[model samples]
Target: MQITTEVVSGLERRLNVTVPAQRVKSQYDARLKRVAKTAKINGFRPGKVPLSRIQAEYGQGIQQDVINDLVRDTVFEAIEQEKIQAVGMPNIESVDVNDAGLTYKALVEVYPVVTVNSFDGLTVERQISTVNDADVDTMVDNLRKQRQSFAVKDGASADGDQVTFDFEGSIDGELFDGGAAKDFKLVLGSNKMIPGFEAGIVGMKAGEEKVIDVTFPADYQAENLAGKLAQFKINVSQVETAQLPEVDAQFLQLFGIDLAPNEGGIEKLKADVRKNMEREVKSSLRNQLKQQAFDAVLAANEIEVPKAMIAEETTRQRKLMLQQFAQQFGGAQQFDESMLPDELFRDKAERSVKLGVLISKVIADANLQVDQDRVKAMIAETAESYEDPSEVIEYYTNDKQQRAQVEAVVLEDQVVDHILAGAKVTEVTVDYQELLKRNQQQQG
Candidate 1:
């Protein structure tokens, strides 16, 4: 066997593997002999089939099988011999089989040699914020809204009011599927219905009967109803106004605070809310800082990521997106990958691959390892959110993949910390609300 490799382009290698025809013939003959020992033939007893008959019947198939096995085995051997750190599976360009030899060319993408520059010159701004009493009050207000109740009102429905009604919608004097409902409850400003639907229901009083006209948006999901004016004969049954729960002992107990300690549980509840808020604020700020550091590192270093790696990452992200869509829309088995274009995720996949390469290099250069203490702490922190903290901790400790994911996160944070240690970091103090608003904007 002889093997040779040449560069096709950036990170791509063309490997030529040539195997002796005698080797193929020898293997083919050996497999035929083995098959003949237990060969099944209609005209002859089992194991009594002649070699000539077996060769005449199964020679081509046996030879092809032998060649496939030989090629797969020899390709890996050649890759090992050449010390090529291939990314994805190799593409066989062509195969030539002659009496003299069997030769094939494989196109493979090798991992790029990544060289990360020093981070001393990189500058990243770290935003710091504190969860003040006002932030706690806002969180408490939001929590109260979450636990709000509703009371049927005699007056007209308004914004934030829940109205229950029976509606029959028709377009062009013809009723369509899913155009009618009985006793459907809708919030006036929820926007659950199409444009003008909620607004039409608003200001309607209980026991009122009215005909509301709405025109569907041009980009509506239903083709039959898109841009069509529809009339809904609505009979409003009841209008309910929202009533937020008072922050008292019952509410505090609802949040697992059995004892108040002092100040009629309000102080304790505020303290707890403030603590959680502080933790969340700190986490968000750390994430922002880490992302900035990651961007800085990438901007400082440039490396050609292997197309194979990017392709693999793209496939992974595409599958993840499909899974999320399936989970959200309830058609996991029926979802088609074609619905999502590759171009949609190409940029993100490329950046993810590049960052992965850069982070790996940083880890190697800095000799960073996953800290067991930090891993334990992370597990504990995660378990805090679950009902059974010990069970969650046990699950992480026993599950290798889950633990590895956590370890990777911890290791990435270590890399970020290492970068921040040497890099010029500017501390920017931002208001808690402003920081949260910025985070929301970025997420949006």
Candidate 2:
């Protein structure tokens, strides 16, 4: 057997292997000997069949089987011996088996050679948002609304009030699909209805009739309804105003905030709200900084990624996404598999694969390793957070795959920290209200 390899690309290789004719013949002869021992043919007892007859009967099949096994075994051994960090699987494209030497060729996708320098100098800017008095007051008001009660007001509807209405919708003078509803409740300032629809209802009094015309957004979720102009004939049933809950001990108790009956529960709740808001603000800032670090690294480094790995990762991502979609859409029974296009997700899948490769490479280049102590601590912390702490710990310890997954995350964090250490970091103060507004915009 002879083996040779050629570099097909930066992270790909082609292995060419040849088995000499003599070697093939020797193996065939050895297999024939084994066959003779158990030979069962007409007019011939076991172990007594002629070699020529056996060859004539089953020679091609045995030879083909032997060649297949030999090729598979040799290719794997050769790859291992070459010390290549192959990902996914090798694709065999050419194989020739005959009385002469057997020749086979396969393409292998391997890990890219990665190098890193000046990773410690990565500079990232973080928005340091602080919760101020205004943020605290706003949070308290939101909490009050959360516990608010509604009372019917026999008057015209106004902003910051709820209105109950029965409406018939029409498209081009004809009743349209999903166009009619009875006793729909909408808040005037919530913007729950389409643009201008809620505004059109604000000045109308109870028991009054009105027509609200609004156009659907171009990118509306329902394709058939996108950009469609429709008139809703509505009857205002009743108007109600929200009555906010008092900021007393009872109100504070709703949030597990303990305070004396006559104490300043309002101020205490405000402080608590500010603390929570600051935590969330910092979390968002950290994520932004991490993203910046990733971009900086990608911009400074160039490495060849294996196509085989990308294809494998793409499949994995698609499977995960499809499973999540199915779960959210109720179940497999309700899922229309054809509704999702492979083209729609392919680009995102590829990017995820590329990022994974980059992360792995960065970890290797930076000598980042997951400390066993840290992994154990993380497991212990997670277990402590659960009611059945011991059971959770036992589950993780007993499951090798789960433990390995956790360990991988720890390793990735180490890599992130490594990059962060060398990167330039600047912290700037930001208002909590501004952060909240950005969050709202992102959700919208």
Candidate 3:
């Protein structure tokens, strides 16, 4: 076998591999010989089929199979001999078969050589947060409000109140699409409607009738209604006041806490809420730190990323997004592919590929290994939230793939930690809500 390499621009390589004709003939003849033993025909008995008959019946197929196997084997051999760090699957450009040899060309992308700079002066800010009693109180109250009940009241609607009404919206004395609905129900402060629409519902009494004038914002989704003045003729049919459930025995029971058996059930529930909040705070903080670490590392280390890698990552991100949309859209068969273009994910894909390369390089340079203890801790933390956490832990412990997933996470965390240790780190104390808000605003 003979191999030649070509540089198809940055990170892309073309391998022109040629296998000697004798090798191809030998492989083909061997495969054909194996088939002649049990080759059956209309008249010949099994194991008694003639070689000429077998050759006539299976010559093309055997030759094709041999070529396929030889192509794969010789390509890998060429890659190994050339010491190429190929990325994704190589593309077979052309294959030729003749008396001289079996010649084939493969297009492959190699991993770029990346060098990570020292993190001695790199600045990374780590957020420090803790769940306070007030935060716990707010969380419990929000949970109660989520399960809140409402009753029809003989009064005007107010914020947190639900009102059912009939409304007909018109723009300049002309109705438009989606301009009218009968017996529509809305929460007075839900912001489900345009800015002024919900505000107009406030202080509306049951069985009342009124006309509300609202101006659509310039950025309204509907082009025709954007920045236009509209009037809604509303007939209020019912007004219901929101009532949050008390944090008593029944309310505690909703959270799987039986207050009858426990004397301090409410307090215990508060502790549980605080524990969950603490877990959230820890996870969020770690995510923020990891993101910062990744950004710092990427910025400090400059490397030209492989376009093929970015394309692969982009394809992966697109697939994941489509899966999410499928779940969201009620399993609609056949999606409109045009809705999500490659450009939408190109930036993220490039960033991801760059970070992955940088991280892998650091792992190699530092000779970092996955911490089994950290993996166990991470798995335990994940199982903490599930009922029968022992079973959850057992599942992860028994499943190699699942545990390997956890191990990967731990290894990544270790990489970030190693970078943070070498970098100039500053701790920033932020309000619990403010930290969460910042985390939510951050893009991957």
lDDT of 1 by residue, 1-444 (tens): 888999999899999999998998888889999999888889999889999999999998998899888889888888999999998898888988887688999999998898899988999999989988788899899899888889989888999999999999999899989999999998788777898999998899999999999999998879988999999999999999999998777888897776546444777788878877887887898899899999999999988998888888999999998989888989888788988888989999999999999999989999999999999999998887677999999999999999999998899889999999999999999999998889888985
Every candidate's CA RMSD: 3.7, 4.4, 4.2
Task: Give the higher-TM-score candidate: 2 or 3.
Answer: 3
Single out the weakest 10-residue window by summed lDDT for candidate 2: 332-341
Q: Candidate 1, which segments miss by more than 4 Å at Cα? A: 41-50, 165-184, 189-237, 259-264, 325-331, 334-338, 383-402, 438-444
Higher-ranked by TM-score: 1 or 2: 1
> What is candidate 2's lDDT per residue for 291-347, written digit by digit as tens?
777777776765557766666666676677678887888676665546665676676
Which structure is stronger by lDDT: 2 or 3?
3
A best-first ranking of the candidates according to their TM-score comes to 1, 3, 2
Model 1's alpha-carbon lDDT is: 0.90
Candidate 3, residue 176: Cα displacement in angstroms equals 4.3
lDDT (Cα, tens digit) per residue for candidate 3, span 1-444: 889899998889999999999999999888988998778788988888888889999999998999999998899899999999998888899999987789999999898988789999799999899889999999999999899999999978899999999999999899888989988989887778998898888999999999999999999878988999999999999999999999987888888888765546988899899999999899889888999999999888878887778889999998888888899986736676577899999999999999988999999999999898988899899999999999999999999999999999899999999999999999999999897777666742
lDDT against the true structure, per candidate, is 0.90, 0.79, 0.90
How do all models score by TM-score? 0.83, 0.79, 0.82
| Top-TM-score candidate index | 1
Per-candidate count of clashing residue pairs (backbone under 3 Å): 0, 6, 0
